[model samples]
Target: MHLHKINKVLICILLTYTVQYLMLPFPDLSAEEGVIFENPYKKTEKQTDVTQFTIYFTKKSHLIPKQDQVRLQSVADFLYRNRNFEILISAHSVEGKTNKENVLISEKRSLEVERFLLIHSVEPNQIRRLFYGNSKSPNLTKEHEALNRRVEILLQPIG
Candidate 1:
């Protein structure tokens, strides 16, 4: 009878250890904890990538300076690579002497970018333009005023 009791204790201890070993390996992935179980068998969809470019201007200057010509050429290369993409150029001016003068400057800045792209053989049809006169920069700081005078080129993929 004493031997019988020992056997029963050993069985209980073995069962306890086995239960702990099995339970420790997997976490409780219940919905209550916001743990999601992904289906490993499912496939993923392909995605397209869009690109953007920016060019900053000097105070009261509409020309693309000699230093920036290489940068502009790189952008032209990207445009050529993605032939189906459309370019949206938003030109902005720094705080100027007058609103009218600022607006004119902004237009000239956009035209200069457009002309540069055209000269690089980018299609005119792929380009759309907008200009913002001495409107404040999204970045509001005295130093960023030079940054405010700029063009934002947004590239959108076509279907």
Candidate 2:
């Protein structure tokens, strides 16, 4: 009779411990209601006045033609038409190149784009330059990889 009572107590203790363990909160718990996500295409009232453009580069050519100045002029006019908008220029290169070379090329491309925008009357303060050499590429082909070696422009709404 005493052994049977002890067995019952042990079973109850085990069940209670199991339940408590199951009810414990996880360390990495996140509240669903507190999470916030950003939308890329959906413009808010805050973003009402920004236009963005991207320029892709190939090994063949890196410069916007000095003779054909309309391209740069158009970009400048677009920015002027927008309110509180700034441009972020990023340059990317493909993988397989040495880190040293990649960094050099990416900086060169970013600077080149910045110069073009500056010459077109875009304010130095309004432009932000970035570079990622052989780091981020959409197309991962040997031939098409060079296409990734390009400069991208992002127009952001500034408050």
Candidate 3:
């Protein structure tokens, strides 16, 4: 009787462990998150004579600098002159922060650029914003890596 009781207890413990292991969720070992920031601009396959430009964030703050506006205005002017082109706004961030925080920061930066463009009379429909928060770093240098926190403007031909 004592032997039978010990065997039953061991079997129950083994079954419990097996069930727990089977119910555990697996981690996402794939690289789907790694590709979120690649080619954020979604540039179309149309040709245009307008020159492209870029605006860098360089930090996690919500402020947009005046010089950045100057650059954006220049792009806006080019868009005004050549109304047949579309602007792709790709926003990026640094790699130290949490993914959620990085995504939010990138989004804010993109929105700031979008607002600046709209204020300058650029059509809302003509501009598209892409947030890549820290997934891709343009500047690999440690000091300048923060500069990778920026938005790139890609100009493509519109239909």
Candidate 4:
């Protein structure tokens, strides 16, 4: 009789939770600032005229690859010329690793990019870093994993 009563209580509690969860409203995803930043890789007509580009990294590797050096240097050179602009280095990694490990890897990647820009004479103040672990995957496909492992550089006017 006691066990039956306990099971009934558990069922009631779970049902209450389910009902509450089902009734909850969806979250608001709109930006509070009203300014939406477009992915630099996919520039549409409206997103054009924004100085932005992306440099890709390999799996589990933070150092900028040899082929990508020229591209990264170009970004650094652009910063040298554009004194009013700040570069946002949004780094991402996808290894299906733990959150902590993913974040660490992404941070390392962003830092490596920052170091390279600094070496190329880009102003340190003009560089902003954002590290996102595997949390933001572009897609689940094996091919998309490579796409997700990248650093996107977007140039914005300093406020």
Best by lDDT: 4
In model 1, which runs have C-alpha deviations exceeding 4 angstroms?
A: 1-50, 139-141
- Candidate 4 residue spans exceeding 4 A from truth: 1-50
lDDT head-to-head 1 vs 3, winner: 1
Each prediction's TM-score versus the true structure: 0.60, 0.56, 0.60, 0.64
Indicate which candidate wins on TM-score: 4
Deviation from truth (RMSD, Å), model 2? 17.2
Candidate 1: lDDT of 9?
100
Residues 1-159, candidate 2, lDDT per residue (tens digit)?
A: 999999999999999999997887895775563121232222322212224444455463456434223444666666666647777878777643586677677778788877877776777777788887777767676656645766776778765
Residues 28-131, candidate 3, lDDT per residue (tens digit)? 55434212232234333321223565554545764576655666677888777777877898888774468788888888888988888788878877888889
Clashing residue pairs in candidate 3 are 93-134
> The CA-based lDDT of model 4 is what?
0.76
- Local lDDT at 50 for model 2: 23
Cα error, residue 75 of model 2, in Å, equals 1.6
List the candidate numbers ranked by TM-score, top first: 4, 3, 1, 2
Worst 10 residues of 2 by lDDT: 34-43
**Each model's lDDT:** 0.73, 0.63, 0.71, 0.76
